[model samples]
Target: MTASPADAEAPLSAHHRKKQPEQVRRALLDCAAQIAAEQGASAITIQAVADRAGVTKGGLLHHFDSKQALLAAVFADLLEQMDREIDRTMAIDPVSRGRFTRAYVRACFSDRLLGERSLWGALSVAIVSEPALRSLWSGWLDSRMAQHAETDGDPRLVAVRLAADGIWLADMMEKAGGLKRYPQDFERVLLAMAEG
Candidate 1:
């Protein structure tokens, strides 16, 4: 016996609802990332993303209204992934917040899996608007840093942030081992500073 149209349609609708928005969001970001990685960030456009995702422009817009929103979504998604990874790493016994920072620095530098280049490109575009993206990104970073800075003084936080910045630069340059070449021995010194 053949299934009725109504029964077939019901399963399809159920499958659509079961489709995770987060998964779709990640796929969209991945497409944008691939485009940016190949031809730089300017290659990322609404049409390009839609084509890459095999979705119609209207469908893409349903999830992300504008190019700026899409770019921000990509950045925000990446940050969320990083936060989750850090959370897992910090689940270790006696995981101080500073250690988490250190782990983040190391991970961001060593693992290109985060697609840091594409993210940097996207971030540059987002921040050029100044008011819109900067506020969003700065708020997220500041909140995370502040949460870690609890009970610790500003000096330690600054030190840890500076260390993270250095790690970011080193990672961008593919100089993972060069952290050891710093004259002041930043990894050890910064850890001490954060702990103190």
Candidate 2:
């Protein structure tokens, strides 16, 4: 038999031949997040995400039933990432009393959640305007609070978390407005509160 150009090429691997469902879903989510970060949540349309992910609209719809569902999933994914980051930060703390609160404070200051160009900043407006997204956020916060009821129940620690929330909002606003409204030591003050 004569060898042809096709015979010289290696066979395609299973990975190349077939796309895993999880991989496709993750790609869609990442594309949605990127679009939101760049152009705000309003830009996360089905066609946009599908096109960005290199998947057909039907493929994207297979993972998410609707645009609202996709947005919810993206919001949930961000919260899950934040939760993991908080857990990682908490693991390094030697103190157990306010460890969770301290981790939350650190996470609030982390780049993942801060700045206008970040996913959280881009989604903040949607979180406020969309009830579904807001509810998901509130549920996540409530679950975390309940989970750490024993270790982070101190009123002072709660105050620290509240302060961290303010700091995060202020930082987002500052970046969005191109102004410096918060003091340079705001994070330091919040961390100090977490220590108590």
Candidate 3:
């Protein structure tokens, strides 16, 4: 049989069949979190993540050039998860001006997230401590507050949202070995405020 130009491209297609870059990046991020969860944030080194993901250090580096980048990816993953959770909750009642704050508060109280803040809190504290990611982290915080500025522009509306954030932060800190957690009724009161 005669070989054609398509045959020449077969080798290139075979190379493309390998795992895409995103998959590798996600693997590294997952491994990093697993490491942090099991061994604490200080254990989330590039080699540890690369080993956990079963990828070469170079391959891991290809997706995340340094440990700080990998840590930033973990933080980004948390932000993305929170965003998705908020949107999912917002779908329940989207019309009200308070929907944004309500959804945000409800999302923070998700069964998966409620009272399991140790791992997340520790990782977040470490992520913020990284000099390379501080600006990006701060920007995320800024945008999070500003996101509802149009519908939630009123001081009262903003206060409810900020209060929700404060409540969640305090709850997480309490879980991180601080004082006792806020009263269980706090969520109920916050929901009322959000709806008011």
Candidate 4:
């Protein structure tokens, strides 16, 4: 027999239910990240994230107590992804000196991490404006630097990293203003600098 409309609308069995707490939380974070990447940080409202994730506002709140809290969590998640990317890139480098610096430069230029329309582009402003977010980023940087001090502590390597930061800032500005200021081979130059 065919199922009735009411029966069809009934909730699935426990085994079939996929919206576990952790899954729901991940969905909420993914939705929030998409909104930020597409429309900038100002567009990430609780209601918008809830709608995008197919959850109620209350459900979103149950995962994140406030909008600021949600933003911080999103920022932290991005940092974690970046850390993993850096490690993955570092592993392939046979050079001992400046390996971490080279990996960092590569990660910054990676399309997956900081591409033209990446979440980092959207959240850059928030990182500067929000002290808490800035602190989180600073802490992450500090820890990474400490961990890689032996390999990446040379002044020349530090200069390479600083140059990479400048390139990143320029790229962000180019995205924001539609201006092509940096040359195409900037990454190559930075990588070469990291080598020496």
Tell me the TM-score of model 3.
0.76
| Ranking according to TM-score, highest score first | 4, 2, 3, 1
Predicted candidate 3 versus true structure: per-residue lDDT over 171-192, tens digit per residue? 5556633225555566678788
> Cα lDDT for residue 55, model 4?
83
lDDT by residue for model 1 (1-196), tens: 9988888876454336666767777778889877766665677799999999877788788899988888777767667877887667667627454665655554444343344344653355446554666777688778876776653336656667677666555544553343445532455565566565
Clashes of each: 0, 0, 0, 0
Point out the higher-scoring one by lDDT: 1 or 4.
Answer: 4
- Top model by TM-score, which number? 4
Which lDDT tens digits does candidate 4 get at residues 80-157? 999899888888889989999988888777763345468888888888889989999999999999999998999999
Error of 1 at 149 (Å): 2.5
The global C-alpha lDDT for each of the candidates, from Candidate 1 onward, is 0.65, 0.84, 0.71, 0.85
**Candidate 2 lDDT, 1-196, residue by residue in tens:** 8878886696876457766899989999999999998888899999999999998899899999999999999999999999999999888899998888888877776763346668887887788789999899899999999999999998999988887777666655566442256654666788887775
Q: Give the Å shift of residue 189 in candidate 2.
A: 0.8
For all predicted structures, in order, the TM-scores are: 0.66, 0.86, 0.76, 0.87
Candidate 2 wrongly placed segments (more than 4 Å):
1-17, 112-114, 171-174, 177-179
Candidate that beats the other on lDDT, 2 or 4, i.e. the better one: 4
Clashing pairs in 4: none
Residue 30, model 3: Cα distance from true site in angstroms: 1.1
**lDDT comparing candidate 4 with the true structure:** 0.85
